[model samples]
Target: MQYYARIDRSCIRPAKDRQVTKRTAAEMDISSSIDNETTHKARSEGATRLNSLVASIYIFRLLFLAVCAAVRIQLDNGRYLVVFKGYPFYEKRAVRKGTAVICSCTRAQCNSYIHVDRDLNVVHEEIHHSHEPTRLIPLSNGRYCRSSNLPQMEFIEMANGKVCLYIDRYTFYQRSPRVWYCTNNVKCRSYTALSPDMRPLRMKIDHCHPPPKLLLNIFMTQRGKERLVYHDYTYYKQSRTRNGFRWGCTKNRWHRCKAYLHLADDLTIVRSNMEHTHSPHGTPLYK
Candidate 1:
């Protein structure tokens, strides 16, 4: 005698495939909140594991996970976690992007990072760090912990949990008069704008500027022919000059605009002529 069992079709569905209900703006009681919570090591470990598991998923859902006041938003373009201000870390969201997101650590010296699309797919990743990562300093203003030798922007967590930019003596003196950028090197199509007062502004300031367009391979250009046109002058062929590297736009790669930049050793664009093809409507520039 053969026995038959009715099977549930949804039992094998992916964990990320479940429906995610997004709370309305009014639902979050933490609009401009000051997160005073300290994440226990266990919670941090949970977040770390959650991040790793999400990174392994092929298809992602619109997900939101909050661990110790830090919010993680999984979008169609990338997976981003917010290390809100006033905490030990300061992470913001990467608006939607169309291009494949790659790790920002460009130098041959850097390698242990991954870039995931909003759908949580690992589009590009690498592990090139030749040295131990910087220790997590208690209440430090810098974002990523690093033994970085780059001239990068350091934003300070405010009393209200928002952030304002901070430029140390080395960075300020090294790249004076240059506007700062929050790009993941020149590898991804995500950029954050900062106000003159060093306030990290939303990319939608006046008009939405497209993200930097180029790969880290440009650093390995053998011919030395790759150049960027900034201020009507084409430059950015120099490497190993600053504490980091610098480059200009590939003539608004796939767009009609002129913008350029200088990056720090930490792979952050220090200065540029901010112009883009879209407004801050919260949409990806490309699909």
Candidate 2:
């Protein structure tokens, strides 16, 4: 004998109800996907805005730096001078009802001028320069000053008894009574002016080439005599020839050194035998 169990039809869910529940879950998934897409789009837009802001700030900084480098102010002789592009300009007068100031180039021969507002902004300018830009040198006090104030020129005596002006390691020969031009005049435009008492007044332009290597010089002895200076050696006039003069090393009398050289009339080395019996004098220059 077997017993049969009966099922309640009201307790089981219908097919229509099950399909409605599945549709509700699918709708929630779609809504969540839309929300995620919106969040991603917002983040991307925020990143773009931040990059644009950073770029704008960098450009502003570069503009400010360019302006600063283009203009400079300096105090000269209790007066203010405007230094623009390495050229100094003096205040000539005020124009535009005192709203703008007219500045002329400090160099007397230069006719360049500029009109600047009260805030040092250039309004009008004429950039015709007759000379090269002024050169500035750094001072010990961390300030920059004109190189004209410091006249540290050196005088060099050549082997031919001619004097040359040495400044900043470049050699300049005398062109006139008061002017000295660079040795390499064809390629270099550097020159130096002198005062009445043989003092350096001003120097113009920079050297376009390297300094020349000087291996020979002439030195004056204590007894009003001249000596030919070689590398760490002093030579005395031994004999006079038809073409040139012969020089023997000064150590010949003491150490029997046989170093000798023949110099032409133009003070050029014609022949030389630099073998010495002893060590060199070891002096850079003879007094």
Best-matching candidate per lDDT: 2
Looking at candidate 2, the ten consecutive residues that score lowest on lDDT are: 278-287
Question: Lowest-scoring 10 consecutive residues by lDDT in candidate 1?
Answer: 166-175
Residue lDDT tens for model 1, 96-215: 475433434323444455554555454444445565433221111223322242223343333344433322211111122333333232432323344465433332111134433223
Evaluate all candidate structures by whole-model CA lDDT and list the values in order: 0.38, 0.75
Q: Tens digit of lDDT per residue, candidate 2, span 1-287?
A: 99988999888899999999899999999999999999999999999999999999999998865654335555333456787766889888999999988999999988999888877888888889989887664432334557676534556687577888756446789999998999999999888677787655555646789777666776554355667667646688999977999999987877777899899998889999998876553222222
What does each candidate score in C-alpha RMSD?
A: 29.7, 16.6
**TM-scores of the candidates in the order shown:** 0.17, 0.38
70, model 2: CA deviation in Å?
6.8
